[model samples]
Target: MKKVFLLILVISTLAVASQLEIFSSSGEWAFFENPARLLSMNKQGVMGSYQVFSGEGESLGTFLVGLFQTPAPNIAGVLYLKRSTLTESSYRTTIEYDAAFSPEESLNVGAGVSFTMDQEERKEIDLHGGVSGYLFKDVGFGVSVRDFTLWSQKGTYMGGTYLLKLFYDSSRKNRFSYSLVFDQEVLENRIDFTIGSEQKAGLGVSVLSNTKTKENTVKISLGFYATVNNVSVGFGTFIISSPVSSDPFSEYYYTQGTGIKFAVRW
Candidate 1:
């Protein structure tokens, strides 16, 4: 009887640890990040970004390269290659292809696919789609389906995830933008909300507040972006509180992360 009890306890411990692992390895991008913004593309170029996090004398990093193409007038496509690494032994690489179309002046639609692979030879493919439209002159709304079709290496089909976002921009002034975003991950049964804003000059300020299913905790992030002579750069930092756990060996606590991005366009 005691042995059976020990087995169950061990399993519980592992499960908690796994959850923490996923939490700690989240990407550096903001919760409000949406690739559908490319639907309004007016320029073509390449961009590269690198972000790093430091904690407990260890560092994790991500690097990305993006290519933008305008095959014809009013149509755009983006291809991305990204690599994320916690250590030499733990890493993931992904390739993504996305395209956008503007059927008229006020409506935009997009679709994408992402292929990801890890060190353990596990593979996943995620299908994505989205739509955005202007309600009035300056107010707009969008809905995105991420992982709409999830497939694994063994040809297994997983579930889907979705996100909804509403935004407003001052087209006349081109100086301010605000957004509300909600995300749902069906497989993990997790939901999150984010409210974000940006005030633009040659230098821009961006801020966001996010709340998830966790109890009594909220995550906040502050960021900045700047553009000069066709080159753009951005940086951000976030604060996250670890989920509650009773296990003594759990390395759960509050943590912080930072990210940086850069791009050049003609």
Candidate 2:
């Protein structure tokens, strides 16, 4: 089988890391790659992250540094880096950053760039943008477009992703919240969906999946701002065998990342 660049080691790393969300699966982190809600705490913050992914019982390790902020009460920014290894074989590294603005406390717009390396060679760049807010009490929606590379989306690669979320918070103070995110490739693959709920002190749950193939991945996440007075943590697993099994012929393999997170605020 001819080695497809998409299956290269660097690409697999991005795939597993896909589970992390760095924020949420639902697009709450839409302003950037993390999620819309992740930006909910737009104030300046930082965190440490780690993730492990197992494909066909092969375990890979990933370590990360994540940080974000709201330059102003309505402005936000985020930065992160991931160092990964597959069985102690140095695989890939990624660096990314995003900045945004919230107008009238109901809208947000942002963009981001990611630099990925495999064998220390530039591998991929991810770009994104989204806006979110409520139409009425307990009702909100968010839409996002990601400038993904062709390999990430397939040959039809529009190089984009779109996400929409509907949520209702028991508390309206932006203190506690929950939302359902339906994200799709915009023009590729299946419908990728996510369901998540979160609270003020720092804790949450999420389930991500594919619509057509019936493949499902579930994850449990927690954030404790208390380290900087809060804590952040997360875990997740995906059912890759159901529809599209791991490429047994996959020579150019790549892996993604996800895991525990710790951050401090100044």
Candidate 3:
């Protein structure tokens, strides 16, 4: 049918609008928080992170402004901005706003909107919602969904994504934690899995693998941080390796990058 053909064409044209692989903020576990984590009043702050792709030729930068304390005890909000550049020819920018609510200690829910623009002047909008909560003793689960629409001169393209995360908190008072995250890019039929562990004393590690790609690329990330005068400073690095590519004309098979972040409460 005409509708089926249009849908397929739209998905193919907007596949390039997929999420970017940027370094997490402060710690590798930050990726788990980016999509759905609710904000607590005690944790409001401003932070910025920058990362390079493949050690060169690509880079991403992000800034977060959070409002954790308000007249209402159950509401919080955040603003996120991100920019990325690839090989000097392609660039993208994203801006999003999220509002979160906690009805009780065991439940959290949020909704957000995001807008993105690329080098070709194409634009896309995303409407997302998420839910997360502690299910059992020290164990938690989260789920998030995103509906995206791309506006082009030819027609409009629609896509969707969903993510699931499971985490364990060993000590609620800033101790040790571990989590597993899975992301599904529904429209594109791609999936990513990640595992990460962190310590409040400022050390963490993470690993990510893509299931739908033949390139066999794996990303490993490490991070450490410390606090001084109520300010937190973090340093992190990422390494990407792929064993299947050897041709000189192929993309970089091995790449390493470093990033740093600083945050303070006010």
Candidate 4:
């Protein structure tokens, strides 16, 4: 059988609480980090954003709604609601929060947490705690370990997911901008990797794939985002080849979708 464990498969139903952010306050963060960020907006004020996404991959359909605030001159507050229900698994929901503080002219630090339903059988990896920071020259980085506590229930063997992201681009007007990202497993023998770029007027793409051979596969990502009079919207898609696992007729597939996001200052 193919270990097509497309982990982030629960895109349809999850119960989660979240916060809406005003990240597009500045045209500098236009793409919402999705490459589709060509959107425009305010620079030094508060802003709120909400995004709804849905698509299909190796598993059933996945859909999600995101609300958050972008980093500004002061501390940033955020919330996220994520629900995953696919295969034979029950509906799983996750609630998360992010608070950031700026102590220097060009540096920042923050922490976060996610609460979710517990599975006894998947003990030792349910609760997650994470931290993030920013560097100099418009470059920033974030890392979080989900399910750090590893709380398990029933026979699900529930574990947490880890995420890491990096972004860097200039704020020059009418100029080309670019960005990149990386994601991997927290404590298992699995890893997912991707790297891509974007532009100012709204144009970009990226490649996503796995490191291990049996699971070796590749997908290209395309995205764009823009704003008009405090309203921002974004769209993205990923295309990949069929399954490479044994029994190629195992109903293999990939993913592609369009997303819309809106934000305004408080």
Candidate 5:
């Protein structure tokens, strides 16, 4: 019982931490993360993703669906719905709308709004915005502000989350990116690193590290994605290692959990 409780606690903490940072570098989900990336899409498509995390008899599941389109040459938009289940009777749903505008070839700006409702009917509204542009032909920088509380029926007005990102693309085929994220309410800092290819079938990996605590928590994710005939599919898995405790006679103990994801876009 103690082990199970500990596992649940760790997983829950990790889940909340994950929500505080931008994880996607680029893709259909990147718009959901940073909004400015909406302009990066070249075609209209719908995407769906499902993910589950499990450890020590406790599990959490999330489902997301997104629709993206470019109605004009310089504008792109996306709408997405995300639902997560913490327990059989406990769940939360979020719906968001985001749009990006590129006035020039090298500059993009975006804004978004979202509403979230939990099982208890508690509702919250959040605002998001971002700017991204190329510094050189193959290097870019981005800044985003997320989770700015517009209103909350039962929650306090926490300040917004901020992220600064830098990325380099070689021939627009492969990318390496890094982001520094700050959560104002929690006073926490996290760093994310990712490397991947955007063409054909490719493998990618991402690492996230919490820099606020001495015993940092690290999450590593690996995935493979392929595109064919305007359809894309992805398979991914992630492992999280969190420091649990330290004993007088032994080194620090760590707890680990794993999760899997499946996503498709067409």
Candidate 6:
């Protein structure tokens, strides 16, 4: 019984620690991070992705389904559902809806709301908002807030997490971007740097630091994307650095895992 309890505790800790590191604001998943980016989509499309993270003895799987549409000349909206499961008895599901409005050609503002439910039927609601626009001819910036709880079965909180991102696009088809994320609730911060072409392939590196423990984790990703006749598909993989565990039972902490992603839009 003691060993079973310890195993559950370890898995829960790993899931929480890895949650922030798995998703990216670049590529097809941009709307997942900043809803304001949906304004850039000109056509209505549906997309989905499945990802798995695995370690020595356990694995976690995530599935996502989303769609975006332009309702008016300058208004766009997206709706998505995400599910994460560690075991049949342990899972979480979230549904999110976001909309962006462009008042001018170069500027957009957006807001989103999400509802989440866990295996135990605990429910939570979160609000998000963002702004994105061009600063220079080919330079742009985005700012967003995530996870401001409107209500929760556990409790209610204010102060959502924050993200700031900047990007530069060259006429030659290359784009470079940097993002910084601050999450006060967990006392952790993350930085992501990516270089890629909107036409083909890209590479990215991310560093996540725990302010309280002063420990840092590094992750690397590579992906390729293609577009044909208004349809787009993308594939990517990532690997994370492992953390050394001091636990007497476990040799290596499960914080490190490899994952792959696939997404398509039409």
Q: List the candidates' TM-scores in order.
A: 0.67, 0.61, 0.65, 0.53, 0.75, 0.77
**C-alpha lDDT of candidate 4 relative to the true structure:** 0.36
Compared with the true structure, model 4 gives a TM-score of 0.53
Could you tell me the lDDT of residue 67 within candidate 2?
65
Error of 1 at 235 (Å): 1.2
Top candidate when judged by TM-score against the true structure:
6
**C-alpha lDDT of all candidate models, in order:** 0.51, 0.48, 0.49, 0.36, 0.62, 0.65
Candidate with more favorable, higher TM-score: 4 or 5: 5
Task: Name the lDDT value of residue 8 in candidate 4.
Answer: 19
Candidate 1 C-alpha lDDT tens digits along 1-266: 65445334433432322111111101222211344546554566665565555445545566676767667776778888887777444777888888878888888777889998878889988887777777888776666666554778847565554555454556633423343333331111222222222222222122222234343334445555555554555666655453222211112222455665544555
Estimate candidate 1's alpha-carbon lDDT, on a 0 to 1 scale. 0.51
Residues 1-266, candidate 4, lDDT per residue (tens digit)? 11122111112112221111122213433322221122122232322222222234324333344444545545555555555444445445666554555565444455555566522223222443334334655555544444444444454443334545554544323222222222231111212221222221233333333434435444444445555543444444444443332211111233332333333332
lDDT of 4 at 254: 31
Residue range 1-266, candidate 5, lDDT tens digits: 65455334434443433211123545666765578888877777666666565544445666676778888889999888888776455777899899999978999999999999988999999999999989999998889998799999866775777888787777666666666665542222334343445432323333333334434555555555555545555555555564323311111122332232222333
Question: Per-residue error at 43 for model 5, in Å?
Answer: 1.8
* Number of the predicted model whose lDDT against the real structure is largest: 6
Ranking by TM-score: 6, 5, 1, 3, 2, 4
Please identify model 6 stretches exceeding 4 Å from their true place. Answer: 1-28, 156-160, 184-198, 243-266
Prediction 5 global C-alpha lDDT = 0.62
Q: Which of 3 and 6 is the better model by lDDT?
A: 6
lDDT of 5 at 57: 47
Least accurate stretch of 10 residues (summed lDDT) in model 4?
Answer: 12-21
* Segments of candidate 2 deviating more than 4 angstroms: 1-38, 88-90, 150-161, 173-258
